[model samples]
Target: MKALLVKDNLPDFNGHAALYQMTPAHEGHEFVVASAANVPFSGPETYLFPADADGEIKSFAELDGSYRGGLSHAEALSNAGYTIG
Candidate 1:
């Protein structure tokens, strides 16, 4: 499995006017503290991807454990027609 860390923030209204039309656009994705010492406003949050994730994944985990972010890399890979168990 792979993971991608996505920083959370308010959408930029000035640069992305079209995005504003899409209300609640920032509702997706989960965020977790990278470390115990890391504050909510500082440090990177871990975003776990499935083993079947496309392109590349930042974290790897067994299928038995709960996933942290979007679809697992493995699941994504399976959806893309790759056989991985």
Candidate 2:
């Protein structure tokens, strides 16, 4: 599974129009979460796009259609302060 890995550059907690629309709504909205295990690296912040699908938990790549651009593994690993090979 993959996500649309990007920086948490959202403006405000209640200010970013796009994120605001992401709030929990009806049956269509689902809540899924992913976590890190101190393997590599990434982020001052990042968010799950589309907030997962109804009863769906996906990996970064799985977040495709729901998200746009993405970062490379090397970049992400480097960003998280890892020594990329």
Candidate 3:
């Protein structure tokens, strides 16, 4: 699954973004951001689809632990013609 992980550093007040490809492993999944430059900035960076994207934004609490937030990013990418796991 391909995802865009957005990070923000609050202390530095800088925001970084990156595209990642996630793969399911034996223990868990692996998250690899494509670019080092497009990384997050703050300690608690929120990951969600941009408003313009044709995807839904579900709250963390609403997920109920059934689905991982990273899956949403994969879904968005799949919808946009990217392959996902």
- What is residue 28's positional error in candidate 1, in angstroms? 31
Shift in Å, residue 32, candidate 3: 13
Candidate 3 worst ten-residue window by lDDT: 58-67
- For all predictions, the C-alpha RMSD in Å is 14.3, 12.9, 11.6
lDDT order of candidates, best first?
3, 2, 1
Local accuracy of candidate 1 as per-residue lDDT tens digits, 1-85: 2223333222331111110111111123222112111224544222223211121322434222222333243333333233232
Highest-lDDT candidate: 3
At residue 26, what lDDT does model 1 achieve? 17
Tens digits of lDDT, candidate 3, 6-83: 332212212332333333220132332211122245233224222212222212222111222232434434444445
Higher-ranked by lDDT: 1 or 2: 2
* Candidate with better TM-score, 1 vs 2: 2
TM of each candidate vs. truth: 0.19, 0.21, 0.21
Off by over 4 Å in 3: 1-18, 21-71
lDDT string for model 2 (1-85, tens) is 1222233323333212121112232123333222222223532332233344332333433221222133333333333332222
Against the true structure, candidate 3 has what lDDT?
A: 0.29
Better of 2 and 3 by lDDT: 3
Q: What TM-score does model 3 achieve against the real structure?
A: 0.21
The segments of candidate 2 whose C-alpha lies over 4 angstroms from its true place after superposition are 1-28, 41-56, 59-85
